[model samples]
Target: MTFRHAADPVAVTADNWIHTSVLVLNASYEALDEIAADRAVVLIIGGAAEAIADRESYFAIRSTRVEVPLPQTIRLRRYVYIEHVPHGGDQSRATLAGVLRRDRHRCGYCAGWARTVDHIRPRSRGGPNTWDNLVACCVACNTAKADHTPEEVGMRLLWQPKAPTHRAKQQRKIWRQLAAGHA
Candidate 1:
């Protein structure tokens, strides 16, 4: 698809195009990230990147000085180095906020609204603050569970907890492609 901005061929409101997805490419033309159309336009105008592909339906973003088409894909003008961080393991400590977000703030036992976190294996018994050991819990469930393990209290867990997977595979594939191109 292509976009035209000259003479304002068609009126495109910011509200209509702001939510559009724009694929971002690194300076080497490797996929980097996906960002909103408005942000992409800002990057393009700021001279940090240039549009590689414009949307098929021409949408004009007009200014007193110039106009530009909404971009479908953009490439950075300079190479950006990003440091990779390893995903946390089962032994890694988890935060209360992280646990709540992972469970979508729903009780692990009853699927009710959860404002607190529960330890599957009681902390008193040496349960670590790891992703696999923590679960979001409602106030009532937390009180009932006390310092006892779920098995001991006869309360079955609705789901087994584990460390959340980051986009490692996708990132590896992109890296491989970049390596091959360099070779």
Candidate 2:
């Protein structure tokens, strides 16, 4: 469903279509090419970019209190560029769900049914939730390991999860769209 700012002067009607997951990029900053709208909100909320003022009035929605997408490009507190990062083999970012699927839902430990996730290094011990440190785990194995380090628990991982050398997630999405069209 499309959402609009409560304070918007112009109403968004049936003619205007909205799509989620629109990508935003850093135009000046030497960072990754793009991020999702949700992440863009974080950057805006964090004072990284001023909403492109020229486009604000034309946005699909407007709320004085909350952040809304500007209809026009806004200048970043630093230069920011917004672009649709196409899905392809070279892209680095992959969704959590995609990572889990790549691992085939198998616990690095026991290899039984896995529905949960485990950190190779416990978070309490300072593990960040990146793809390399995460693995699909069964409930039983997770409970068995608990908050302790793997060495402390005497458990061993069957495979070391690594970041993909090539971006498979984008390829997968393209495949899905292609398959859907054929169907």
Candidate 3:
């Protein structure tokens, strides 16, 4: 769409359109990643990809020699391999930092800001440092439950401990594919 003053008709409706997310698919139609709309357009214009779906309400972006309807999804012309990164899970080793991050620094017992992680079953009792056994804890709560399970301390956890849910974005393989001209 053409850029104009906000009050002008047919103006660029969204100043942040370039930052809009566009899903990218592998040539085999497997899902790959979400990329910026601008990048998707470049891929379309450069003949590296094809639009699979257009944006809702029919918005379009124009450059000096090309005008492409903004895309909601695009597919690469060539199939590329994606490597899956091992993700954190309930049984995975839970590091102090990872636990705090997963819990968003909120104590599992009191829902207060947490600076540490506590073992649901005290380490001395053979608690493994796994996601299922750890919770973010404030200094006070940690001290109060020291060397004891929540049941023994008569404290109840506000939330269950678990691994954070995050999609595994592909990495490293893109470079290799590009080097081999398969991207």
Candidate 4:
């Protein structure tokens, strides 16, 4: 989306499309980092990283290619191990709500207004309740989808649920602060 900048006479690419950020997590359910929405789109389409967002958009990056948010979290084809960045508690694996907040409440099922989280494999089945195993779930959907897999419940997920990539949660924090503007 384009917007006219008050600071400049020329229209500028309002970071709106890129407003949403993607978090990349390690296979171990660790907070690795974050990526811009555009870059995340690239990774999702090029088959590098699978989208963990419940809802993804078909963003026209540079008006050339389109990206798809994988319904499941994807691992890199090859192991290019990076530094393992630690998040909160070593034993405290992030909850689905925490993951959703980290993901800015974007649905891991549809990228819609998500206030709840869904365990991909269902906690009742020993799903371990980890970040990679969970995604954001909206209230009505989550209620209707209690203890059932997407397939079993007849709901399709938009993207895959994987650990976040490590970039700069700081960047997201910065955005939040900027948006809040010292309120």
- Show the colliding residue pairs in model 2: 5-61, 5-62, 25-81, 25-82, 26-81, 27-80, 27-81, 52-74
Q: On TM-score, who's better, 2 or 3?
A: 3
- What value of lDDT does candidate 4 attain over all alpha carbons? 0.57
Q: What is the per-residue lDDT of model 2 for residues 1-183, given as tens digits with 9 covering 90 to 100?
A: 444342455554424424222233334533332233343454465565544432333444433667466333333454422345554233454455756686888888899878888887888999877777788889999999989777898999898887653434443543344344434
- Candidate 1 overall Cα lDDT vs. reference? 0.76
TM-scores vs. true structure, each candidate: 0.55, 0.46, 0.54, 0.45
- State candidate 3's TM-score: 0.54
CA-lDDT, candidates in order: 0.76, 0.57, 0.77, 0.57
Higher-scoring candidate on TM-score, 1 or 2: 1
Ranking by TM-score: 1, 3, 2, 4
Worst 10 residues of 4 by lDDT: 3-12
Q: Model 3, range 23-140, lDDT digits (tens) per residue? A: 8899999988776677778878878889988865688789899889988789988888764556643334678987887888999999999998999999999998888899999999
lDDT of 1 by residue, 69-92 (tens): 988899977776654546544333
